[model samples]
Target: MHYSLPLALALGLLLVACQSAPSDTSTSAEAMADATPGAAYQLVWSDEFDGEHLDTTKWNYNVGGHGWGNNELQFYTDARPENARLAGGTLRITAIHEPWEGKEFTSARLTTKGKADWTYGRFEIRAKLPSGVGTWPAIWLLYTDKEYGNQGWPDNGEIDIMEEVGYDPDVIHSTIHDKAFNHSIGTQVGDTLRIPTARSAFHVYRTDWTPDSIISYIDDQRYFAFGNTGEGWEEWPFDHDHHLLLNVAVGGNWGGQQGVDTTAFPTAMEVDYVRVYQQK
Candidate 1:
């Protein structure tokens, strides 16, 4: 996505509006197949976070302070429970304000880069997001192929199934990045919605990807779609395997636009479960 650049940030700019009570808007892992046109969807891989610790077999930690091309403030550390933990049947990625290892804030970025990368499939994550300004929580996918070298992003492709900033607590964002359509060039394919329960209740953030199109959804409600342009790989590089990334960033570009709420430290993005289904 080259999210490092602020091509167009709708959630970062919008203030919360139309307040309402939180309600359930979840879509089951098995429900997409009936409406999905393809081989019947089948369960493949998942992590329910039911254990006391993160399962190393399915995930890896991206530990660093290099800004990740996004100028993010958090120092992503490895195996630190305060930054990432699994308990009570959920995986919690907590972002807090504190001085540790020479960084002002600490958080965790979990990825399935080598462990479970996939091509076309339906991916779902049930999560309750963090609140307050400056928090940028995202559930996104990055291309995993090594053929293009360092300049592969945007060309390789990126799928942002869900992203919510702290200040705009009511909106959720979904977008797809490619060479033909990207934020840097102002041609990115994306959409956003305001959901009152976004930060307060658990909802399913999803992507239904096939050979023909890529669709994003929340609580079973479809909101964004990017159809295969039939042009070439420059516009549709999603035919290759991509890995998942989950993290909450602080004060950088879009997330830090309106200023950070110092009092919101230790806020968390709690993920109830993550599941993937592939067309069989």
Candidate 2:
């Protein structure tokens, strides 16, 4: 959810070992409904990637190459099977080093903007990351509607459930940005956890959001939490609706800080599933 590069970073230093969490591999709604018994949160929305094609009713394509306010190098394509597709019960978002629309790379960005937006819930995603310098893969959330301030970006809010730069392999990041706490001013609230097998194996990345706070977890261990300070909206605009987004970029300001490795062409972030749960 880093739309623009920051002059400095206040990254969290609480790193921890990656632990394993029990995973529910079920793709049926009936199964998920019964999986979390006596739990505070209940399954409400999900996409298991169990279909042979991307479910249009559940996902929408975001197409563009305008750097997405981050000086990114990939041109996001719409409905392009080469960039985004479903296969073997998983969703593959590929970033290819190819010429397209005057850009050197092409990829796909899928969002659940109008389809699914939530105020407070537990957002969980299970996926294996892509590596090699120049790649930037992310599973994050953005404000669904511009209702707070004039500038939709920092004025609204953003939640980065998981983000990893190829150059810094295995380091997963979770961040939240608002008018008062944004990277532009080097006050963003965020954290990073090193998961050794993040690029080789599937791991669960999650964010539990409530009216009072927003917390992030890896596998099932908590690493970061930002509590609501009775402060103004500039500090916590997450009280409104936000939607999910998934994509892999070729390179850009942060992702291309060390420069892109052309040899790493055709890399992909493979997602097993995305599930959302709200308190019952």
Candidate 3:
């Protein structure tokens, strides 16, 4: 059959083979990638959070008690089900009041750094945010460079698809940090979206990143945009591959601007799914 896109042809061939051979995750996920509504982008990687456990093949837990560069109160733990777990089709990253490793709170930080890195794609995540004074939940992306943290942040590029500070309910943030423009110098570019039901309901947070521009949205409605300046990586470090990061920090600089409620512990960021699509 004649197809308008090259991906359509590649997918058609993969599906036909799937029906004959024993089905595996690689092909099955591919077949379902473009099934979602959008501009016909092909799914390169995804996690539906459909298991009794957090899918290790797609994620790694960033565990530590150090401040995480944010002076966050929570000590990020690894594999502690109460901190991070998948159940009933959702991945919950919880922050509890109990102390751990010198920190008064415990939480989880998950990443797909080495396992799933995409050059440029339409990255999306459906989640229910946690809200309470001092809570900070974020879904973001970072460059896959070896000099990322060592050389300093922003220089490596950071894309915040969605971030919410607990005290300000319903006000969502989308930001991009680079050497030329960043929060440290007060020149970062970002915006807020007020969605009344954000804390109690699920929403799709998306970012369409390409070679030239990065546009973000909340349930398909655009709110923030950053385009290439063609000057250098200092201003547009997004011209390379990046990985995903999902975490809920507690009492950090931004989240603690109003101080920790203390009663706000035991909150969490519930992720229903994460999908990445690219135009092949």
Candidate 4:
């Protein structure tokens, strides 16, 4: 019953899995390369969108189109610069088709909730995606405030370090939504990777979050993970502060379930940088 936190993040993007199979994504990429974070990680925050604009002290545009709950059709803008920008150094976002307040399409959702939040880290994002179909790009994380329950999405968690679906082009996704393993009761914890030039180039979409687990990667290889089940926060809510988000959605309910291709309108989702490391 109770939905609404963008309809429980648009029904936690339904992947429909009863679950229980993971563990051999090359042995979870060799136990996440023996617990990543070499040299004990340190970066702590970055944006490398190399000055040209969009550094509003590290992002926060999340405007709206009302379908963010995933009926999505794009209209999220904040004084639109062709729907978010910053040229050569990267951070594109684009998803234009025209129209505006009435929503035909327009994009850009950038966020860092209150400008950089963390609690166990490693999140990275060197991007390059935005293909034909309805496009849905993402690089997520949440719980930057609502603590838990009722509106904090799937009850205080979500991580999806990267998701893609321009009609499943490169097939990369990595999920984790809580309230007892989400995807609306399908017991969702997730993983997937296909690569094959993941939409033309650039890779490195990662996440490592510690304090038990939450692996995921693309360039570093580890397909995905979701450990901490000390049986609380409804299957572990990655304890505290979380942030990041970037967008490109256009069609919804899983990127328009095989529709919308208006010549892939303006399409984009560049982002060449967005580091954040910890454990130092």
Best by TM-score: 2
Give per-residue CA lDDT, model 3, range 1-280, as digits (tens).
Answer: 0001122232353344334332332233233333333556888889999969888989999999787877788898989999999888999999999968888999999999899988888999999999789888899998787454446576878888988888777888877777765644435566678999999999999988877677888998877766665666676778777899999988776677778887867888999999999976
Candidate ordering by lDDT (highest first): 2, 1, 3, 4
Flag the better candidate by lDDT, 1 or 3: 1
Listed in order, each prediction's TM-score against the native is 0.88, 0.88, 0.84, 0.33
Off by over 4 Å in 2: 4-39
- Residue pairs in collision within model 4: none
Give the lDDT of residue 222 in candidate 2.
69
Cα lDDT tens digits for candidate 1, 1-280:
2463332453332211111101110122224434574458888999899979999899999999877787778899899999999879999999989987887899999999999999988899999999879899999999998444245877888999998777778788888777766656545557787889988899999999887678888998888766675667876788889999999998787787778897999899999999999988
| True-structure lDDT of candidate 1 | 0.79
Q: The CA-based lDDT of model 4 is what?
A: 0.77
The best-first sequence of candidates by TM-score reads 2, 1, 3, 4
Write one digit per residue (lDDT tens) for candidate 2, span 1-280.
5753421333421111111101211122123333333359889999999978899999999999999988999999999999999999999999999999989999999999999999989999999998789899999999997878865988889999999888788988887788877756545557678899999999999988877667788888767666665466887788899999999987788888788998988988999999999998
Stronger candidate by TM-score (3 vs 4): 3
Query: Per-residue alpha-carbon lDDT of model 4 for 62-167, expressed as tens digits?
Result: 8979996668888889947897889999989889999999999889888888878888788889898988898788888888866667857888887888887777
